[model samples]
Target: MNHLKVLALSAGALTLVPGLALAHGSMRPSHGGVVQMSGEIMVELVTKPKALEIYVTEEDEPIPAADFDGTLIVTAPGGAKTRSALKAVSGNKFVSSGRPGSGSKVVVSLIEKKSSAKTFASFTMK
Candidate 1:
């Protein structure tokens, strides 16, 4: 009877392991920037003086650079809008040539090259 009880306890513990693994995701900014999730992917935006860099990943796995076309739209506080085309630089990172200023509204869109499926994330610059 004790052996059967121990086996039951072990099976219950094993069930929790996979559930914990599925909860894994990184909200800690890897690049010292803002991080947000669009569906299952994490989008990290790093703003520089002259450019904007977006890093995309799914559960910490790098999404292929050649798989998508991306764009960034920046809307200023005064309602001016600027759009930049992002090109993949390296390792799941897409970069465009404009600095969306502080408090500005920014929208990022990535369209899959093969399926044309779209994914979007919106952020307000800080």
Candidate 2:
């Protein structure tokens, strides 16, 4: 009976292994960055030279960064506030020319529109 009990436990654990390995696709941010869920919208942030490149995800899957709209918010080294606009620079990326000194955080707000539905995501400068 003890051997049978051990066998059952092992089988149960094996059945649950696949559930632990599921990977959620798409990109997300690290520290000082967050994803907010709004009415049919998502807010995301991504890093730029001195700007924040924001991309809105209209679908559940990750969309190329080149097609995203960029909004950059910079908190200057001296605690001043500045802003810049981001434009698509290349494949899967957006960029800005605003020079936010070191230690400035770039907040990107992107919006995505899909067949009558919209979503969004945000990324921070890294």
Candidate 3:
């Protein structure tokens, strides 16, 4: 019957809505920082007075920081740019020593060691 087909179609469509909503996963920062999505990976930028920490995750699960080589690029409000290498401290944490001034734009680039694939995440220091 037409009514039965319509009901089934509506139910199927409703099911897909939830999947679409979850496709992007959570954007909330778990490490008290700003979060950005790079393809399927999530990058979190945590800024400290003396250091900057980067966290990488996929589907909320951490991907080992040691698996990639990374760089931290910071651009000041006056257009001055500084680059520093990020070292893997432990687990999913990549860190660099430096404080980006307020209003500075910070970008972290991670290159997978095995595949040479790059993932980038950017943030504005506040």
lDDT winner: 3
The TM-scores of all predictions, comma-separated, are 0.79, 0.47, 0.82
**Candidate order by decreasing lDDT:** 3, 1, 2
Which digits, one per residue and each the tens of the lDDT, describe model 3 over residues 1-126?
A: 999999999999998775543465678999999899999999999987799888999988899999999999999999999999999999999888788899999999999999999998888999
Better of 1 and 3 by lDDT: 3
RMSD of each: 3.4, 7.0, 3.1
C-alpha lDDT of residue 11 in model 3: 94
Candidate 1 residue pairs in backbone clash: none
For candidate 2, the C-alpha RMSD (Å) to the true structure equals 7.0
Model 2 over residues 15-65: C-alpha lDDT tens digits? 977665543433354323355544443445544455444444433444565
Model 1 TM: 0.79
**Candidate 1 clash figure, as a count:** 0
lDDT of 1 by residue, 30-69 (tens): 8888988988878899988888888888878889866889
Model 1 lDDT at residue 45: 90
The per-model lDDT (C-alpha) reads 0.86, 0.52, 0.90
Q: Which ranges of candidate 2 are over 4 A from the true structure?
A: 1-10, 16-19, 22-62, 115-126
